[model samples]
Target: MAKQYVRKKEEVLQTTVTSIRHNEYYNMQKMFDELYEKSSKNESFESLMPIILSKENILLAYRNIKTNGGSITPGTDKISIKDLKSLSSEEIIENVRHIVTGKRGYNPRAVRRKDIPKPNGETRPLGIPCMWDRLIQQCIKQVMEPICEAKFSNHSYGFRPGRSTENAIAELEKYNVYSNLHYVIEFDIKGFFDNVDHKKLIKQIWALGIHDKQLIYVIKQILSAPIMLPNGEKIRPLKGTPQGGIISPLLANIVLNELDHWIESQWENNPVAYKYSVRMNKNGSENKGSGYRAMKKTKLKEMYIVRYADDFRIVCRNKKDSVNIKIAVTKWLKDRLNLDISEEKTKIVNIEKQYCDFLGFKIGLKHKRGKFVTESHVADKNLARETEKLKKQIKRIAHPADDKDAATQTYRYNSMVMGMQNYYQHASHVNKDFAIVAWKINDLLLHELKPSRQKGRLARKGRELTPMEKERYGKSKTIRYDSMTGIPIYPIGYVQTKAPSNFKRGKTPYTEEGRKMMHKDLSINTTLMHELMKQTVHGSIEYADNRISLFSAQHGKCAITGVEFRDVNEIHCHHKIPKSQGGTDEYQNLMLVLNEVHILLHATSNETIQKYSELLQLDPKQKVKLNKYRKLIGLETI
Candidate 1:
């Protein structure tokens, strides 16, 4: 028995040794593959294939980085953007060239990952790409974007350049112009990006006209390279591209476009009809004023299958056609692409009889006045999802102590809310239902801006404090502003503007000195705040959105002056009763005026200003400010 046990132990030891040797051989094979790739550099352009990954391409890539936020994280190499930017232009070029050419073996160093929550309460792993890796990927993407854009079908909008959900929505809405009995089938691929079969994806790309051997070699090497996880364990992905990589979206689009082409081919023999009617002016052509004129009769059957990334919507004539197409598509996906259909999500519904939720819109036909009109409204689930995200962002922005930063946050918050509203604005319930919700959110945000009532106030002993004492108390006291729900907080400052209304906020004139003082007081950082404050009013998003609506409604012409607002700076909002005269903040009493007209009204006497104000149909208040410029320029009151 002892002899048998010893023999068994020896056998186990031999097996372990063999396994270790096998792994070593496998790792060495990866190195050999890279070496072979390097050796092929001497080959002709015909053999090597030209690509944007070369040294000459780094300039445009660098420019894009600089134009972008230029944000970067310390990777495994411990290199950050600051370190990269510190180098001379020539040195930066050399460094990028070496990295792309794989002087050192290319392996992406992954950062700590956090799971992002989905609307369905499930979480998916999200990896942060190293800065160096991102730069390299960005360079590659610059090369690929235009090529993909030209080749990709206009119907496939997901992750492509200049395409958005709204674009896809607009394309889909084209069918809605006419009342047609269409069966809607929408589905998604299960774990689309995460479970992508690399070999199949590459093959599809090759079939789609990518014959570049060098690019292919680089892709294969990167895909095969081992990635270091957050826990410091290095593991190679078996299949599928990681989500964080910049090239992932482009590659995914390339693969999906093949699927789109195949589906299109299948529908050619049996085309489905999409009917719509556009309202034409008395002229022969469409009316330019009405952006997308409601049509009387239009047919668009070319887009039977509309795709945006993994989300797909197929319009068919009947249940039989829908089921047949779904089966064919699902079978092809499983058999050829090795991708699974999201069974629970894949469904067909008669949209004419019942509403089907597609890409956050509840789409159906509404019968009114003996006509069936296609109607789409914001889905309750999508609105709830967006609102939840907005709440979290608001909580984060509200926590900072600086009022300017808080204002900047408010601007961002309002922009996000407006973006949502833009998509849902055409919905029937938006004005009545969503508007109330938006107002309540604004009230909540305004309440946050006010000093927190939760903190204790300082009081004097046995006496009511005088105005002087109260002023001193206010100046001396400091209260801590705790962030809500433990959201991350950062101080953000508003971008100081030189608009005519800037003077109205305080006592200073809208001059260079006043602008400098405003900048100093706010501690404005132009680099950080410039893009964030574009089209915003003093960093107020709500104010900017309101102004935009008024500008559009009034057709870029001043209501009072009848002058075209060629520049946004020339436009101004005036109150019927000045705030100094105890006017309330009401929309009905507000009027749009030219900047010059506003200054003229404020500088002149109440009697003089009232004459023209009445002519302009404005309720002129008995409030005026003596203008120093009026006397300097010898200007008379209107």
Candidate 2:
């Protein structure tokens, strides 16, 4: 009243309850019925939803308007036909516009939805698509299909759409096409999950006409789903975002199937349709020049899909096929699904002779040679020299404490031998390089024993030598016995040492009380000597008389011929019946004779001895001659 006496009427915008009410329930019921029918036909859940929602624009618009708000006002007021006819066209248009703009009622407020916060405190709403990832996935899926078809048949192993890219690359190289292809195109889908067009995906699935409970579950997940984190944070994954999730593999598989189908369709009408038939040529030796001879036509049927999670590798017969496949896939994604491709990361290369790295493996052709060639540089020369020096040092020591210590010191040597053997075995089934040379030093020392003094005519009295001289002489004569054997020994080059003997005697040098003080000192010397002796006399014989080689034919006259040839210094014992002729070394077989005569008698035939010596050489006849000789020499014989 203070500003003006008259004021223009204010218009208010308002919404009736009926305007907010939706036919969503009815539409959803219809969809459910269709899905049920599809399910009855055994269609998959992913292939059922799109058909039901194809004409439900009203429902979608309602959802969008509810969440984003709009200016449409709802009312039941009626206008008379006479009033409408009285109004001009401009007035009617203005009135209709006002109604549509909601100028006559209270405006409704937009619904506010809570956003999930990331680790960095950034908030994001669910159901957004990532533009970059979609492009990459499309690109990869397009590139791989033709190559797979060419390399493998429908019945081949790993023919699924989700086959490993590495395997696909290898199969291509096996066909000898990878090297000719120089440029490689790689594709990656950026933010695939965040950018997914759920509606489009549903349409695609529905177009397939499959229906199942799984589809319902997927739909529920697509709407109002929550992802729980270890840190107690909850998030809702966006529709097209590709990331870690239980449903990721399934979704990725779905995408791959679509891409595979698209690629196959494109190839059906292409100029390279003939090339697809060449897969049959994979059989026979004639295909060797093309690298397909080893591959069986039957076996080639199974290599279609190559998938490693979200990454894809599409195989094609030629570069043109690869590029065309990419273009077709890109068009399908962009025109049908509103997705984009990332060209920067997409590359095409020839992987025929070399390996194509995928999922941490370098996969390439399976050559007839089938050998792996590495491109790493040889080991440093300094390191090799150092290793060789260490090997020499290890070779010098014969015995080590344990195998572990020995292995540590001689690692290079052992590795060399084993590696050579392994290499040969791999190359030719023979292990000729496994030879090892073992060496040991055997030091043999010799010593001689000299009598302390001379006897009889050879005796030298006062000249027996003093203690000091004796000590000097003993030391001079004290040849160091073999370190191995107690007897005088000599080294004969390098020989393996014998295992130490078990003396079997419990001998201790120290007294019970003194044991504690001298135990170690006394035991060491004895143990060392025992060990040396054990090693030295390991094969030699021992006797009490110390007269080694007691039996000798050197003395011409035998002991039995002593009395008969008393003046003769040479003598030998004779056997009436030679030992070789069943004779024994008993008194009856004993006879004395000159060395020459004994030899002569032995040289005579056994028949001669039996006929002549047996009678003429009888004990009494031999005793009479022996007595005459003995009397002349002042000796008695019997």
Candidate 3:
């Protein structure tokens, strides 16, 4: 049912798992801040090359690209980060410089084309950028991110740092719950990533003062790069950036930001959101945006929009405004971005009888406390699909194995369940949904572990129990594993209200500490990290086993940096070809490296190498080895 819901989005299958993810600049945060300040006040920039090509900026850019997903995905040249680890730091940095500076030419290689199955049984195309192109894209992205952040809508959540689907949902709630909005205009621009107009996007970028000719030349080339399909057929794009490129989302946002601004001008900005806003105090309430009498006299109807990537929703207090805004938005996108809002998915519905799906949430109006409140539930279709996926995963991994293998299986099982929990931690019914799923998984695990079909008490008992179990469950039992190794079904008892988010949303990322906050924000789902360890999404025991063996083989030293890893999280099992960009997970593919060193090995950024060398007090020889691995994994060597 979930997959079947969006029936008309055919062209999107040609892009990567691209719609889903964003934020930040580091070290050069202040420099970017200055750009943001200038841009916020509507000024143009020239001669940004020094900062963009500066050793530090390039290093930080690589840092972001390497640590984030996609460092491993190959481009037209069929080169990925794995191929770049041998480059010395100077060689890598010089490579990025040459690409952007036109020393080696700014032309990007063709995208290595691929497709992955979407939940809807449709395949999504992945235009994977080469390591070199990816690095340069990030280099450009880092410079442009802060400037763009200065101008992006608070309502725009896609690809920006700190903003998320939940945040977008919360904004929807503000209009639906706090206000009297009743009608929903829900729609997504079909094939938005694939259809972005190159000329218009560049004009928008220049408008933002990102007018560096060389930089502009590089981006134009990236945009113009061809998509190489599986049969080696190349499709040169006249519009739109590749879905997997680091800059694709930013470009899409920039292109659609025009849509954001136009709509805001009509409703949010032209009159300003507060043109008809309200507020209250402890003792009294006030219509601060306007007096009650003026609000009554005014002919304005309030409209609010919340957007994440290509998908967006416009809410209004009446059908007339909703319909009008929808019509206006349709025209705006066609006229501005030259994209079409999907008629199948885009509908204006009353809150009482119908609802719209956004970011895996079922959003509609709920009558609460004698009033209708805009509320979201974990969509039934999503729960059903996720539970099905969980059941299938359990079928594969929930074996009745003996000894440490049981412990390992238990760890694998918990990771899957926990990942699901974390992915929905921001849900209003996280507790309830997790309970239902966990119970089913628990029952299924017990069934799989039993040597034979056991009835009644035996079935419930679940193998021989230890003293800790008896104390916990008395006569009845839950699934059991090695005494020291595994856990029962993880409890889903915590309430995850949409409490105030500490994240500053669009304002974070390119700011100094925002990158850390962005990483923290994005880390709500660590399961993806493990799932990303391989292409087919295997259980991580093999990966884990390799990490243990490699650590012992090296006596716990990082393979590249040869430094001691103090933290467990720092112990990364890197695929010599990283799974982040789609590497396979065989024993031969494994490498034990500390997280920081892992960055260098799969690196796009150079800050850590510089910082680590100073902190660990490495000699020239050791430092060279570190930089050798620092060869920005995205471009030269890749």
Candidate 1 minimal-lDDT segment of 10 residues? 1-10
Per-model CA lDDT versus the true structure: 0.51, 0.32, 0.61
After superposing candidate 2 on the true structure, give the runs of residues whose Cα lies further than 4 Å from its correct spot.
Answer: 1-172, 175-184, 213-218, 222-224, 228-235, 241-244, 268-305, 316-328, 352-355, 363-638
Q: Is 1 or 3 the stronger prediction by lDDT?
A: 3
Q: Give the TM-score of candidate 3.
A: 0.74
Q: Which ten residues in a row have the lowest lDDT in candidate 2?
A: 5-14
Q: For model 3, how does the per-residue alpha-carbon lDDT over 389-490 read when each residue is reduced to its tens digit?
A: 777765554443543454455445545554455445556666677668768766775676443654211122232322322332343333334333333433
Per-model TM values vs. the true structure: 0.58, 0.29, 0.74
Between prediction 1 and prediction 2, which has the larger TM-score?
A: 1
Model 3, which residues run further than 4 Å from truth? 1-26, 271-288, 291-298, 399-410, 453-507, 510-638
Best by TM-score: 3
By TM-score, rank the candidates, best first. 3, 1, 2
Residue 68 CA displacement from its true place in model 2, Å: 43
Clashes of 3: 21
Model 1 CA lDDT for position 91: 78
